[model samples]
Structure formats: C-alpha cells, structure tokens
Target: MAGTFGNCGALSFFLTGYLQRNPNASAAEVVRYLDAKCQGQPDQSKRQHPQIRARYALNGPLRL
Candidate 1:
C-alpha cells in the first residue's frame, strides 16, 4: 500500500493533467490556482508542500 504522497502515481498524473489544461499558466499562477481551489477548507486552506515548491520555483532553489 502507498502513503498519502505516494499514491499509485495519481498525484503526478493529476498534476500533469492540470498543467496541460492550463498551458499558459506560470508556476506562481498554478500555486495560486491550487490555493484558490482549496479556499473553502478550514485553516485558510493552505498546503505545506506546494508552498515550499512555490518558494523554490519562483524565488530559486533552496540553500540547504
């Protein structure tokens, strides 16, 4: 069995499909879109990994 982030390639597949659908969107745009999509959830609907990825993608690679 797979864990939350290791689910049978579904996450990667979904992300690829989503990016394909929004071909013109930038990485920041994708992050914002994902944030907006989760806006109705509790705790302001924020995600940890995506935010970290956005930081690296938009700002640059991490130091460590």
Candidate 2:
C-alpha cells in the first residue's frame, strides 16, 4: 500500500471491498478505515504514503 497514491483503480478496489463488508458505513468512517488499513501500521517503513484525506458536505455522518 506504500505507492497507493495517485492510483484511482487501487483505491476503488479497496473501497469496494470495504463497502462490501460494511455496507452501512458512513463517508467519514470509510475514510478512516482506509487510512488505517493503508497507513496506520506501527512500522513507519510500511507507511510510505501520506495519510488518506477526504472531504464531505454534511454536518453529520454521510452514509454510503
């Protein structure tokens, strides 16, 4: 997951799988989940990429 930046296909694939497992997930939850899965490891070497970021227009959780 180190070089996942700028790769839309990989991001889509990962998101699809996560959504399948958590169909009721909100937009913010999805962002956090992806960030942890891709870059939350204790080993810095495993997280070569920056943190995942997303913006949503809503005051509360945006359910997908």
Candidate 3:
C-alpha cells in the first residue's frame, strides 16, 4: 500500500470509492470535493500531488 501511494497515492482509490457511492457525480465534481476535503492534508509522502490527483479523478469511470 505504501509503495502504491509512493507511485500514485490514494487519490485513485478514494475517487473510485466516491464514484461507486455517487454514480451520478461528475469527475470534476469529485475532484473539487476531494480538493476541499483533502486541503491542507500532509503530502510529505509525495503521493497526492494536485495534478496527479486530478488526473486520477478525471480519468475515472464516467456515468454514461
């Protein structure tokens, strides 16, 4: 798990869960929500970079 975060963080995992629960929500919305929820959170682990996080969130499954 640590290794995974070191590579890409838990952004994708969280986004996946969020989408599962809120299937109707847009990726952009999830990103905004995550940005707000994760703001000020420590990233010394260098896993949850803003760009990568957004990319993962935006690239997640869409609700067609």
Best by lDDT: 3
- When 2 and 3 are scored with lDDT, the better candidate is 3
How do the predictions measure up, each by TM-score? 0.37, 0.46, 0.46
Pairing residues by index, what is the TM-score of model 1? Answer: 0.37
Q: What tens digits encode model 1's per-residue C-alpha lDDT throughout 3-64?
A: 12444232344456679999988988876665554444322222235544455442421121
Whole-model lDDT per candidate? 0.45, 0.55, 0.56
Candidate 3 matches the true fold with a TM-score of 0.46
* Cα RMSD to the true fold for all candidates: 9.8, 9.2, 9.2
What order do you get sorting by TM-score, best first?
Answer: 3, 2, 1
Which stretch of 10 consecutive residues in model 1 shows the poorest summed lDDT? 1-10
Ranking by lDDT: 3, 2, 1
lDDT of 2 by residue, 1-64 (tens): 4224355434466788899999999999999887766554333333334343233222322222
lDDT of each residue in 1-64, candidate 3, tens digit only: 1114434445556667788999999878997877764664444453435665665543332222
Instruction: Give the clash total for candidate 2.
Output: 0
Clashes of each: 0, 0, 0
